[model samples]
Target: MSTPALQHIAAVGAGRMGRGIAIAFAYAGHEVALIDIKPRALEATAKLETESLAEIGSSLRMLADLGMFDAGELPAIMARVRFVGLADAPAALEGADVVFEGVPEVLDGKRDAFAFICEHVRADAIVASTTSTFLVTDLAAFVTHPERLLNAHWLNPAYIVPLVELSPHPGTSAEVVDAMKAMLERAGKVPVVCAAAPGFIVPRLQALIMNEAARMIEQGIATAEEIDKATRYGFGFRFASIGVVEFIDFGGNDILYYASRYLAQAIDPTRFAPPAIVEQYMEEGRIGLKTGKGFYDYTGVDPDAYRRDVLGRSLGMLRHLDLLRAPGAALRPKE
Candidate 1:
């Protein structure tokens, strides 16, 4: 006879990412219980999660307009979600096959929460942390069953963004890694395994760029708008499919080597040299994007419009490049 399917799941924390993660599992047909410390937080998270799902439904309806489902389907999806407080987290998690800890980005707090979870969760049940900053090995230190702990880092707005970085500590079993990956994929996420390095893969690369961008703004090398334009239109388009290493290989090692040397000499060896202008802008609180006043004024700008426009254009160009054999492939370093 076939074994029973892993059914019940629980998500700890009712923050932005926690709620999104809970909804993702619910959408995938799992029974999910969400736990938050405060009643008001739980109430707000429940409402927001429901609304976000409706927005997703609206987008799908506007685009593909799939008749197989209706807007009412959102409420049905909501029915699968249940909210609980700290006292009930254990009982709520009873029989859970997977448990995700979406706690605050604090090391100590997460340790305490995961320890509490360990007291009740099944020994074999998979436990994961949605920490973007902490290393999986470090967090796993607090887990009773370290072998079952893994870092399942999801980008913001968890349901939509396809990338889910699954990082496992040295003690973590291969089965746990595979299980987490399989389950995330089933829930409509594209899971990528990452080494337990600082900030992992994506964030590490992205951070450097952002830091340099901020520094550029401070130094007056470029305005925030210009910096974004160069990355989005100029460098972003080229880097989307083929990463930097391959780009360098394709662009010819001589240029990359010369550029590296130039940067090494011209720029301070200490971290990304916070350009003088960037320091001033940051001191004055002109941190870009979210702030209405950064290096430029986005006071009247529609943030969503920019996001949709950029992602839409990038995705379109990506598809086109794939069809054309991606000219950047020539630059990839030989394996």
Candidate 2:
């Protein structure tokens, strides 16, 4: 089946997320309808419209100040987004090529919004929920056409953030996913697909890291300031250059396996214990790049060249941070 062009974009529930999404698409030169799904009095609706547009305008101005684009282009970008009231939602939705539901994280609210959206939207139009709390599978049940529904989890400050996690249920159409990915890519966003799992990817990984950081502070291991500085300069900086899984392969999975065992014995066994896959991999001798295979295949790959490439990436990050210094540069003595 041919995927339709997602030219007409609409974001239901004109809250912060909707407004952010509107800015994103409008900045990308798409006309986006920021629709308010809830019924409101004329004055209340007007107030919402004012507040939403003002917030969006402020965000755009901030981005402009940060040199994202020229300040003069703000008006044109702002003009591309139209605020629609509940009365006009049907018309707005009917014309949308893709609809994003940004309603509150209440199950009943989502059910009502999806029911309203599915009624007016075209059968072919893609309906994506900009939800961080609910699963795609759970939301799909509310949609009239399950294949056209999926979850697009955008990070906060949607216009600035590059990543958008796409979670599709079993019944979701592959075409829908591809089309949405293409549209997001065109909008200068990085879209990654994940199964219908809790916390998706970033949140799931970060939860553990964040909790550990808190635990360290609670245990008097490190102050909050120190941990944050370490995270910014070391943990985040390194991970920014290489993915966690890729790092495991680069450093050798055996390192992780052994470290896991040590941590388990030293600290909390249940929390630090290695998964079965790591143990199995160690048993099978499928450790990492050193062994020609691990999380990624390195067959027919030149180890020396790959190592150089990794070093180059790390060097690039250092250069970006202005942390790279000349070989003979002298360090200043503490006064």
Candidate 3:
């Protein structure tokens, strides 16, 4: 939004991720070329273009109605996103500032897409793969300037998600990382740099939480509705205000150390055991808030003010859920 970070953007696939990326750039006032470079029938290509544009248009209109922008500007933003067939791939990619490849998840599909995209895109262009499966290293192996390639793992509905996990290989240039981050930031995205590890950041934590939720249901700990409410009001609300590590330190690491041990013994020890780092921290006496040290340090901090801030945030969440009420509403005796 600030000075139009990238004027020329391109997405090399006509699928959901590609469409979402196109809509995002188009919304930010950049011209985007959504190119489907795979060989296909004329009818199939036309159908793909139709589907992509329709979805993008609907999304733009919804945002406009939600007061994100003037409804009159919807057509102009949608106009910025154009679809190109394989024959026009060269012109669509020429002089492009950034290219996002959102092909299928298989290695062969990714390799083929990269081999084709690399030949047309500028050597310095910030090329990125939207693959949730392979690491940046795996995909960068197909490019000539591997330093220019990175994994920009966007959450589903890229146009709405604020976080973009940027995973770079060991040899990726530092300059590229900074430039890529700047571009994403200018487009109103929060880019987090990560290693070429599997699942980047969100996916890894989400996977563990999701499977555990399913296990709880199977074990009859709570019903589906109750778990959903708890997550929405408790787990999600808290994490939304503070980072996971911050919560650990806010409540004292000793709490987690003991809770983890109890769960490990009561349930599956393999699943609930705390990491070795937790034990090491205990040994060193870094037992959070009260100790003035933990996963985070509280040294020199006004304890009362810090607690007040955290409470205010929680109260805000409660207000949003419409659960806050007057003290007089607490109870009433039945007749």
The residue pairs found clashing in candidate 3 are none
- TM-score list, all predictions: 0.70, 0.97, 0.93
Number of clashes recorded per candidate: 6, 0, 0
- Pairs clashing in candidate 2? none
* Candidate 3 local lDDT, 243-263, one digit each (tens): 899899898888999999999
Instruction: Give me the runs in candidate 1 sitting further than 4 Å from their true place.
Output: 1-5, 37-72, 269-335
lDDT of 1: 0.73
- Which TM-score value belongs to model 3? 0.93
Flag regions of model 2 displaced more than 4 Å.
Answer: 331-335
**Lowest summed lDDT over 10 consecutive residues: which window, candidate 3?**
1-10
Q: List ranges where model 3 is wrong by over 4 Å.
A: 1-5, 327-335
TM-score winner between candidates 1 and 2: 2
Q: What does the lDDT read for residue 175 in candidate 3? A: 80
- Candidate with the larger TM-score of 2 and 3: 2
Candidate 1 lDDT over residue span 253-325, tens digit each: 3444445556757886455344555556556755555555554566787877865765676577767756434
- Top candidate on TM-score is 2
Candidate 2: C-alpha lDDT: 0.94
